[model samples]
Target: MKKLILSLTLAASVVASPALSQTVRIGTEGAYAPYNYVNDNGELAGYEIDLGNAMCAEAKLTCEFVTNEWDSIIPNLIAGNYDMIMAGMSITEDRKKTIAFSDEYYPAEPSRFMATAGAKFDFTALKGLKIGVQGATMHAAYAEENLAAGNTILSFETFDQAVADLAAGNIDLFLADGDPLNNVAEASKGAMVAVGEGIRIGDGMAVGLRQKDTDLAATLNKALTSLKKKGVVDKLIKVYFKDGPFYSN
Candidate 1:
């Protein structure tokens, strides 16, 4: 975990606002495209950003986006580095033990394995293959717990590195969120393909908060519930994911 600099820690304290204030800082990892990522123009842009802004508006609060590295995002939030976290984070019981979560804004997305196109394997008899996963992620934990028995597990700091390694044949497969991996596979244009069944491991995605921030959790939940009812979340998912309005039911 990355430690907050003394100055940044003080700044975080200064920037922290009340639950119903006009402003709240939302921390995100700006590397997960279509969900949360930094654009070439050096601006935060994605489905989470749009949805978070809409939720803030619904709650009559202004939201500011803060980029944090994935490994440090949770600890930093607990350290008061940001008011809340709205990255493409799933709401799992394990995570709930560490932090509070608003009502889910996005449905649970399954995890899938990506491999170089034309690569074949007897997955049932799989052995001696290297699997790449971003470190400290649910996928990493899942892979370690389930797949490490017969394969070498390679942990990377970023999804891009894992994908690059896969493309370069350094790793046999890369496991990640299905939507983003699907997006990347499509962008690869026959270079990469998703293999294996979709693994559903957690609940839907939501805003992560300090476990004690009950008021803020309630405020965000109220806003998210309203947005879901209004179909804003569904529309935004379609805009970014080009897939299902998953919560329309």
Candidate 2:
């Protein structure tokens, strides 16, 4: 909750030397599907996981993933818990004040609102609706700023909780990144659907790093550029996101 309590100055002085020889610990929230998630085999698997592996290989750096709660992901990074964050975190200016970011791996797409199938609501006149969002997320900030004045914005700890609340009719709608929302809606047999035009917020998804980790950031950015040129980023996008290849020209 206290995001900026630790001063950037302290972070710089205390941050661990940008991991080079040691196995770089990449922290991720393994609960966000398609981005990073624990699969049925209890192994970390997802688009981010796959892409991270590719990036590390391209950078010629050894890296391993460690899962952390979303709300504390950045703080833990500042605390030197991990060297990088590849948790589908969007690159926002607000967040940039706290940490640096790599080049956009997942381009700025759009966020969507999910509701029960055929749920009718006016996009322009949105009112009297119970909107659910995971707390401490861009989607939460977006809903609070854009929708809370007219609607009841419910905050949950995780998107899955918000989805559960939507299924139970506790919330009229749920807002999130389009990928997982699409994944859920498609498998819902018309139980859920996306409403309104997509809303673009934040820059895009990128690797989160401590402000001091410029070398690691540069390494990842270079690796991401190479992968994009090789069509690897596009390939992963096609494999994980139906509407992607977002970073492609």
Best by lDDT: 2
The collision pairs in model 1 are none
lDDT of every model, 2 decimals: 0.88, 0.90
User: Total clashing residue pairs per candidate?
Assistant: 0, 0
Candidate 2 clash pair list: none
Weakest 10 consecutive residues of candidate 1 by summed lDDT: 14-23
User: How accurate locally is residue 173 in candidate 2, as Cα lDDT from 0 to 100?
Assistant: 88
Write down the TM-score of every candidate: 0.90, 0.89
lDDT of 1 at 161: 89
The per-residue C-alpha lDDT of model 2 at residue 111 equals: 91
Which lDDT tens digits does candidate 2 get at residues 62-94? 899999999899999999999999998999988
Worst 10 residues of 2 by lDDT: 13-22
